[model samples]
Target: MNCPKCKSVQIIKYGHTHYGKPRFRCQDCGRQFVLNATRQPIDEPTRQLIDKLLLERLALAAIARVTGVSERWLQMYVFQKFYQTPKAIDVTPKKQVG
Candidate 1:
Protein backbone atom coordinates (compact mmCIF):
# COMPACT_ATOMS: atom_id res chain seq x y z
CA MET A 1 0.00 0.00 0.00
CA ASN A 2 1.01 3.63 -0.50
CA CYS A 3 0.88 6.57 1.86
CA PRO A 4 -1.89 9.01 0.98
CA LYS A 5 -0.08 12.03 2.42
CA CYS A 6 3.36 11.49 0.98
CA LYS A 7 2.55 9.07 -1.83
CA SER A 8 5.30 6.81 -0.53
CA VAL A 9 5.20 3.11 -1.23
CA GLN A 10 7.07 2.23 1.95
CA ILE A 11 4.05 1.46 4.02
CA ILE A 12 3.54 -1.17 6.65
CA LYS A 13 0.69 -2.54 8.65
CA TYR A 14 0.07 -0.47 11.73
CA GLY A 15 -2.59 -1.01 14.38
CA HIS A 16 -6.32 -1.08 13.96
CA THR A 17 -8.39 2.03 14.35
CA HIS A 18 -11.06 2.43 16.99
CA TYR A 19 -13.58 1.17 14.47
CA GLY A 20 -11.38 -1.90 13.92
CA LYS A 21 -10.30 -0.79 10.49
CA PRO A 22 -6.83 -1.83 9.39
CA ARG A 23 -4.32 1.01 9.60
CA PHE A 24 -1.06 1.52 7.77
CA ARG A 25 1.98 3.60 8.49
CA CYS A 26 4.31 5.27 6.04
CA GLN A 27 7.97 4.88 6.87
CA ASP A 28 8.98 7.91 4.85
CA CYS A 29 6.61 10.45 6.39
CA GLY A 30 5.83 8.63 9.66
CA ARG A 31 2.13 9.13 9.06
CA GLN A 32 -0.32 6.44 10.07
CA PHE A 33 -3.52 6.38 8.05
CA VAL A 34 -6.33 4.10 7.13
CA LEU A 35 -6.92 2.76 3.66
CA ASN A 36 -10.23 2.60 1.79
CA ALA A 37 -11.71 5.06 4.24
CA THR A 38 -15.34 6.01 3.84
CA ARG A 39 -14.93 9.66 4.72
CA GLN A 40 -14.73 11.78 1.58
CA PRO A 41 -13.06 15.11 0.98
CA ILE A 42 -15.18 18.27 0.72
CA ASP A 43 -15.82 19.32 -2.88
CA GLU A 44 -15.22 22.64 -4.63
CA PRO A 45 -18.88 23.67 -4.92
CA THR A 46 -19.41 23.14 -1.23
CA ARG A 47 -16.32 25.19 -0.46
CA GLN A 48 -17.63 27.97 -2.67
CA LEU A 49 -20.98 27.82 -0.94
CA ILE A 50 -19.26 28.04 2.42
CA ASP A 51 -17.32 31.07 1.25
CA LYS A 52 -20.53 32.71 0.06
CA LEU A 53 -22.28 32.03 3.34
CA LEU A 54 -19.34 33.43 5.23
CA LEU A 55 -19.45 36.55 3.08
CA GLU A 56 -23.11 36.95 4.03
CA ARG A 57 -21.99 37.09 7.69
CA LEU A 58 -23.90 34.03 8.76
CA ALA A 59 -23.15 32.37 12.06
CA LEU A 60 -20.71 29.47 12.06
CA ALA A 61 -23.37 27.04 13.20
CA ALA A 62 -25.78 28.22 10.56
CA ILE A 63 -23.15 27.95 7.89
CA ALA A 64 -22.29 24.45 9.01
CA ARG A 65 -25.92 23.38 8.87
CA VAL A 66 -26.41 24.87 5.40
CA THR A 67 -23.10 23.59 4.04
CA GLY A 68 -23.12 20.19 5.81
CA VAL A 69 -19.73 21.03 7.32
CA SER A 70 -18.68 21.03 10.94
CA GLU A 71 -18.65 24.34 12.82
CA ARG A 72 -15.12 23.79 14.07
CA TRP A 73 -13.90 23.12 10.55
CA LEU A 74 -15.69 26.21 9.29
CA GLN A 75 -14.15 28.28 12.06
CA MET A 76 -10.67 27.09 11.14
CA TYR A 77 -11.30 27.71 7.45
CA VAL A 78 -12.58 31.23 8.11
CA PHE A 79 -9.64 31.96 10.36
CA GLN A 80 -7.20 30.69 7.77
CA LYS A 81 -8.87 32.53 4.94
CA PHE A 82 -9.45 35.93 6.56
CA TYR A 83 -7.80 36.09 9.97
CA GLN A 84 -5.70 39.19 10.64
CA THR A 85 -4.03 40.49 13.75
CA PRO A 86 -5.93 43.37 15.33
CA LYS A 87 -4.26 46.67 16.21
CA ALA A 88 -3.38 47.21 19.82
CA ILE A 89 -5.82 49.26 21.93
CA ASP A 90 -4.75 51.62 24.67
CA VAL A 91 -7.01 51.27 27.71
CA THR A 92 -5.12 53.05 30.47
CA PRO A 93 -7.55 55.08 32.57
CA LYS A 94 -6.55 58.66 33.40
CA LYS A 95 -6.66 59.68 37.06
CA GLN A 96 -8.66 62.80 37.96
CA VAL A 97 -7.21 64.93 40.72
CA GLY A 98 -9.60 67.11 42.73
Candidate 2:
Protein backbone atom coordinates (compact mmCIF):
# COMPACT_ATOMS: atom_id res chain seq x y z
CA MET A 1 0.00 0.00 0.00
CA ASN A 2 1.20 3.55 -0.69
CA CYS A 3 2.14 5.56 2.37
CA PRO A 4 -0.49 8.05 3.48
CA LYS A 5 2.28 10.42 4.56
CA CYS A 6 4.71 10.21 1.61
CA LYS A 7 2.85 8.10 -0.98
CA SER A 8 5.35 5.20 -0.75
CA VAL A 9 4.32 1.67 -1.80
CA GLN A 10 6.38 0.01 0.95
CA ILE A 11 3.96 -1.07 3.66
CA ILE A 12 2.92 -4.05 5.77
CA LYS A 13 -0.12 -5.02 7.82
CA TYR A 14 0.35 -4.05 11.48
CA GLY A 15 -2.84 -5.25 13.14
CA HIS A 16 -6.28 -3.70 13.61
CA THR A 17 -7.89 -0.51 14.84
CA HIS A 18 -10.09 -0.17 17.94
CA TYR A 19 -13.18 -0.73 15.79
CA GLY A 20 -11.38 -3.75 14.20
CA LYS A 21 -10.14 -1.94 11.09
CA PRO A 22 -7.08 -3.40 9.31
CA ARG A 23 -3.89 -1.53 10.22
CA PHE A 24 -0.91 -1.43 7.88
CA ARG A 25 2.70 -0.65 8.75
CA CYS A 26 4.88 0.97 6.10
CA GLN A 27 8.44 -0.26 5.84
CA ASP A 28 9.71 2.50 3.55
CA CYS A 29 9.39 5.36 6.02
CA GLY A 30 7.92 3.67 9.10
CA ARG A 31 4.34 4.86 8.62
CA GLN A 32 1.15 3.13 9.78
CA PHE A 33 -2.08 3.02 7.81
CA VAL A 34 -5.46 1.53 8.55
CA LEU A 35 -6.81 -0.17 5.43
CA ASN A 36 -10.55 0.19 5.66
CA ALA A 37 -12.52 -1.01 2.70
CA THR A 38 -15.89 0.61 3.28
CA ARG A 39 -17.43 -1.19 0.35
CA GLN A 40 -18.61 -4.33 2.12
CA PRO A 41 -20.88 -6.85 0.35
CA ILE A 42 -23.54 -6.97 3.09
CA ASP A 43 -24.01 -4.65 6.04
CA GLU A 44 -26.13 -5.39 9.10
CA PRO A 45 -29.25 -3.81 7.59
CA THR A 46 -28.74 -5.61 4.28
CA ARG A 47 -28.16 -8.93 6.04
CA GLN A 48 -31.49 -8.52 7.88
CA LEU A 49 -33.17 -7.80 4.55
CA ILE A 50 -31.53 -10.85 3.01
CA ASP A 51 -32.94 -13.03 5.81
CA LYS A 52 -36.39 -11.50 5.38
CA LEU A 53 -36.34 -11.98 1.60
CA LEU A 54 -35.18 -15.59 1.99
CA LEU A 55 -38.07 -16.25 4.35
CA GLU A 56 -40.52 -14.48 2.01
CA ARG A 57 -39.05 -16.16 -1.11
CA LEU A 58 -38.65 -12.83 -2.90
CA ALA A 59 -36.89 -12.49 -6.26
CA LEU A 60 -33.16 -11.59 -6.34
CA ALA A 61 -33.33 -8.56 -8.67
CA ALA A 62 -35.90 -6.81 -6.51
CA ILE A 63 -33.88 -7.50 -3.39
CA ALA A 64 -30.70 -6.27 -5.12
CA ARG A 65 -32.33 -2.91 -5.95
CA VAL A 66 -33.46 -2.44 -2.37
CA THR A 67 -30.18 -3.56 -0.76
CA GLY A 68 -27.70 -2.37 -3.44
CA VAL A 69 -26.28 -5.90 -3.62
CA SER A 70 -25.87 -7.78 -6.90
CA GLU A 71 -28.32 -10.58 -7.78
CA ARG A 72 -25.39 -12.90 -8.64
CA TRP A 73 -23.88 -12.39 -5.18
CA LEU A 74 -27.25 -13.17 -3.62
CA GLN A 75 -27.50 -16.31 -5.74
CA MET A 76 -24.04 -17.42 -4.57
CA TYR A 77 -25.14 -17.04 -0.96
CA VAL A 78 -28.32 -19.06 -1.57
CA PHE A 79 -26.52 -21.90 -3.38
CA GLN A 80 -23.62 -22.01 -0.91
CA LYS A 81 -25.86 -22.00 2.14
CA PHE A 82 -28.24 -24.72 3.35
CA TYR A 83 -31.14 -23.65 1.15
CA GLN A 84 -33.69 -26.25 0.04
CA THR A 85 -34.37 -26.57 -3.68
CA PRO A 86 -37.94 -26.07 -4.87
CA LYS A 87 -39.19 -29.35 -6.28
CA ALA A 88 -41.03 -29.42 -9.60
CA ILE A 89 -44.22 -31.42 -9.78
CA ASP A 90 -43.19 -33.25 -12.95
CA VAL A 91 -39.58 -33.78 -11.90
CA THR A 92 -40.28 -35.11 -8.41
CA PRO A 93 -39.73 -38.87 -8.21
CA LYS A 94 -42.10 -41.34 -6.56
CA LYS A 95 -40.64 -43.64 -3.94
CA GLN A 96 -41.82 -47.28 -3.87
CA VAL A 97 -42.82 -48.51 -0.42
CA GLY A 98 -42.45 -52.26 -0.05
Candidate 3:
Protein backbone atom coordinates (compact mmCIF):
# COMPACT_ATOMS: atom_id res chain seq x y z
CA MET A 1 0.00 0.00 0.00
CA ASN A 2 1.11 3.55 -0.71
CA CYS A 3 1.97 5.94 2.10
CA PRO A 4 -0.89 8.25 3.00
CA LYS A 5 1.34 11.28 3.54
CA CYS A 6 3.94 11.11 0.78
CA LYS A 7 1.99 8.76 -1.49
CA SER A 8 5.13 6.61 -1.84
CA VAL A 9 4.97 2.88 -2.35
CA GLN A 10 8.13 2.34 -0.25
CA ILE A 11 6.97 1.42 3.21
CA ILE A 12 7.79 -1.13 5.93
CA LYS A 13 5.86 -2.85 8.68
CA TYR A 14 6.65 -0.92 11.81
CA GLY A 15 4.65 -2.62 14.50
CA HIS A 16 1.18 -3.28 15.85
CA THR A 17 -0.60 -0.43 17.54
CA HIS A 18 -1.95 -0.66 21.06
CA TYR A 19 -5.32 -1.59 19.58
CA GLY A 20 -3.65 -4.52 17.80
CA LYS A 21 -3.85 -2.87 14.40
CA PRO A 22 -0.94 -3.30 12.03
CA ARG A 23 0.96 -0.03 11.62
CA PHE A 24 3.18 0.85 8.68
CA ARG A 25 6.04 3.32 8.34
CA CYS A 26 6.66 5.30 5.18
CA GLN A 27 10.29 5.14 4.14
CA ASP A 28 10.11 8.39 2.19
CA CYS A 29 8.62 10.64 4.91
CA GLY A 30 9.26 8.47 7.99
CA ARG A 31 5.63 8.75 9.00
CA GLN A 32 3.96 5.88 10.83
CA PHE A 33 0.23 5.29 10.70
CA VAL A 34 -2.53 2.73 10.83
CA LEU A 35 -4.97 2.34 8.00
CA ASN A 36 -8.76 2.36 8.37
CA ALA A 37 -8.77 3.74 11.88
CA THR A 38 -12.18 4.98 12.89
CA ARG A 39 -13.46 7.09 15.76
CA GLN A 40 -17.12 7.14 16.85
CA PRO A 41 -18.49 10.57 17.65
CA ILE A 42 -20.73 11.14 20.66
CA ASP A 43 -24.39 11.73 19.84
CA GLU A 44 -26.46 14.88 20.47
CA PRO A 45 -28.74 13.32 23.13
CA THR A 46 -25.70 12.21 25.09
CA ARG A 47 -24.34 15.74 24.85
CA GLN A 48 -27.58 17.10 26.30
CA LEU A 49 -27.34 14.62 29.15
CA ILE A 50 -23.77 15.72 29.76
CA ASP A 51 -24.92 19.34 29.89
CA LYS A 52 -27.56 18.48 32.49
CA LEU A 53 -24.99 16.64 34.54
CA LEU A 54 -22.67 19.63 34.34
CA LEU A 55 -25.45 21.90 35.62
CA GLU A 56 -25.74 19.61 38.66
CA ARG A 57 -22.02 20.24 39.38
CA LEU A 58 -21.04 16.61 39.19
CA ALA A 59 -17.42 15.53 39.38
CA LEU A 60 -15.69 15.34 36.00
CA ALA A 61 -14.48 11.77 36.45
CA ALA A 62 -17.89 10.69 37.66
CA ILE A 63 -19.45 12.36 34.66
CA ALA A 64 -17.05 10.54 32.37
CA ARG A 65 -17.88 7.19 33.99
CA VAL A 66 -21.63 7.78 33.88
CA THR A 67 -21.64 9.16 30.36
CA GLY A 68 -19.10 6.70 28.87
CA VAL A 69 -16.91 9.56 27.67
CA SER A 70 -13.21 10.04 28.27
CA GLU A 71 -12.25 12.52 31.03
CA ARG A 72 -9.85 14.27 28.65
CA TRP A 73 -12.60 14.86 26.09
CA LEU A 74 -14.99 16.10 28.79
CA GLN A 75 -12.38 18.49 30.15
CA MET A 76 -11.75 19.90 26.68
CA TYR A 77 -15.49 20.29 26.16
CA VAL A 78 -15.84 22.20 29.43
CA PHE A 79 -12.87 24.39 28.54
CA GLN A 80 -14.40 25.22 25.18
CA LYS A 81 -17.72 26.10 26.83
CA PHE A 82 -15.98 28.26 29.39
CA TYR A 83 -14.23 30.25 26.67
CA GLN A 84 -17.42 30.59 24.65
CA THR A 85 -19.39 32.09 27.57
CA PRO A 86 -19.79 35.84 27.84
CA LYS A 87 -17.22 37.66 30.02
CA ALA A 88 -19.51 40.31 31.50
CA ILE A 89 -22.92 40.10 33.16
CA ASP A 90 -25.43 42.71 34.40
CA VAL A 91 -26.75 42.29 37.94
CA THR A 92 -29.04 44.47 40.06
CA PRO A 93 -29.25 44.18 43.83
CA LYS A 94 -32.34 45.13 45.88
CA LYS A 95 -32.01 47.91 48.50
CA GLN A 96 -32.01 46.95 52.21
CA VAL A 97 -35.49 46.90 53.75
CA GLY A 98 -36.27 48.78 56.98
Candidate 4:
Protein backbone atom coordinates (compact mmCIF):
# COMPACT_ATOMS: atom_id res chain seq x y z
CA MET A 1 0.00 0.00 0.00
CA ASN A 2 1.12 3.59 -0.61
CA CYS A 3 1.52 6.28 2.06
CA PRO A 4 -1.35 8.75 2.00
CA LYS A 5 0.75 11.79 2.96
CA CYS A 6 3.76 11.38 0.68
CA LYS A 7 2.13 8.93 -1.74
CA SER A 8 5.22 6.75 -1.38
CA VAL A 9 5.07 2.97 -1.83
CA GLN A 10 7.50 2.42 1.06
CA ILE A 11 5.17 1.46 3.90
CA ILE A 12 5.55 -0.87 6.87
CA LYS A 13 3.26 -2.51 9.40
CA TYR A 14 3.18 -0.40 12.53
CA GLY A 15 1.16 -2.07 15.27
CA HIS A 16 -2.53 -2.04 16.04
CA THR A 17 -4.15 1.09 17.36
CA HIS A 18 -5.76 1.25 20.79
CA TYR A 19 -9.05 0.19 19.23
CA GLY A 20 -7.36 -2.83 17.71
CA LYS A 21 -7.36 -1.45 14.20
CA PRO A 22 -4.47 -2.46 12.02
CA ARG A 23 -2.05 0.45 11.61
CA PHE A 24 0.60 1.15 9.01
CA ARG A 25 3.55 3.51 8.94
CA CYS A 26 4.98 5.34 5.96
CA GLN A 27 8.73 5.00 5.68
CA ASP A 28 8.95 8.12 3.55
CA CYS A 29 7.28 10.68 5.89
CA GLY A 30 7.00 8.54 9.04
CA ARG A 31 3.22 8.98 9.15
CA GLN A 32 1.09 6.33 10.79
CA PHE A 33 -2.39 5.60 9.49
CA VAL A 34 -5.06 2.96 9.52
CA LEU A 35 -6.60 1.58 6.38
CA ASN A 36 -10.05 2.63 7.45
CA ALA A 37 -10.40 5.24 10.16
CA THR A 38 -13.56 5.04 12.27
CA ARG A 39 -13.19 7.99 14.56
CA GLN A 40 -14.51 11.30 13.22
CA PRO A 41 -13.02 14.54 14.49
CA ILE A 42 -15.23 16.84 16.51
CA ASP A 43 -16.50 19.78 14.47
CA GLU A 44 -16.05 23.51 15.15
CA PRO A 45 -19.59 24.16 16.40
CA THR A 46 -19.31 21.35 18.91
CA ARG A 47 -15.95 22.75 19.98
CA GLN A 48 -17.53 26.19 20.49
CA LEU A 49 -20.27 24.60 22.58
CA ILE A 50 -17.64 22.83 24.64
CA ASP A 51 -15.87 26.14 25.29
CA LYS A 52 -19.15 27.69 26.47
CA LEU A 53 -19.83 24.72 28.72
CA LEU A 54 -16.34 24.95 30.13
CA LEU A 55 -16.92 28.62 30.92
CA GLU A 56 -20.05 27.55 32.80
CA ARG A 57 -17.89 25.32 34.99
CA LEU A 58 -19.89 22.24 34.12
CA ALA A 59 -18.61 18.86 35.24
CA LEU A 60 -16.39 17.06 32.74
CA ALA A 61 -18.72 14.12 32.57
CA ALA A 62 -21.69 16.42 32.05
CA ILE A 63 -19.93 18.32 29.32
CA ALA A 64 -18.94 15.12 27.62
CA ARG A 65 -22.47 13.80 27.78
CA VAL A 66 -23.96 17.05 26.51
CA THR A 67 -21.48 17.45 23.70
CA GLY A 68 -21.39 13.74 22.77
CA VAL A 69 -17.60 13.72 22.95
CA SER A 70 -15.42 11.27 24.81
CA GLU A 71 -14.49 12.42 28.34
CA ARG A 72 -10.90 11.47 27.65
CA TRP A 73 -10.75 13.81 24.67
CA LEU A 74 -12.36 16.61 26.68
CA GLN A 75 -9.87 16.13 29.49
CA MET A 76 -6.92 16.29 27.12
CA TYR A 77 -8.36 19.37 25.42
CA VAL A 78 -8.81 21.06 28.81
CA PHE A 79 -5.30 20.09 29.81
CA GLN A 80 -3.90 21.72 26.66
CA LYS A 81 -6.01 24.84 27.16
CA PHE A 82 -4.90 25.10 30.79
CA TYR A 83 -1.25 25.04 29.78
CA GLN A 84 -1.86 27.54 26.96
CA THR A 85 -3.25 30.17 29.37
CA PRO A 86 -0.87 32.75 30.81
CA LYS A 87 0.81 31.66 34.02
CA ALA A 88 0.63 35.08 35.69
CA ILE A 89 -2.21 37.56 35.91
CA ASP A 90 -2.36 41.28 36.88
CA VAL A 91 -5.24 42.42 39.05
CA THR A 92 -6.37 46.02 39.54
CA PRO A 93 -6.97 47.30 43.07
CA LYS A 94 -10.57 48.21 43.86
CA LYS A 95 -11.38 51.73 45.08
CA GLN A 96 -13.14 52.15 48.44
CA VAL A 97 -16.79 53.32 48.24
CA GLY A 98 -18.25 55.82 50.72
List per-prediction Cα lDDT, in the order shown: 0.75, 0.69, 0.78, 0.80
Q: Per-residue lDDT tens digits of candidate 2, residues 69-97?
A: 87777766665454355454244323323
Q: Which candidate's lDDT is highest?
A: 4
lDDT of model number 2? 0.69
TM-score of 4: 0.47
Write down the TM-score for model 2.
0.42
lDDT of 1 by residue, 1-98 (tens): 57777889999999999789999999999999887532445667988999888678787899999988877677656765654442433433233233
Candidate 3 per-residue lDDT over residues 1-98, each given as its tens digit: 78867789999999999789999999999999787532445567878999999888888899999999888788767766665553543322223234
Which residue pairs does candidate 4 place in steric collision? none
Candidate 2 to native Cα RMSD, angstroms: 12.8
Alpha-carbon deviation at 64 in model 3, angstroms: 0.2
Top-TM-score candidate index: 4
TM-score of each: 0.45, 0.42, 0.46, 0.47
Model 4 per-residue lDDT tens digits across residues 21-84: 8999999899998886325466679889999998887888999999999998887677667655
Q: Ranking by TM-score, best first?
A: 4, 3, 1, 2
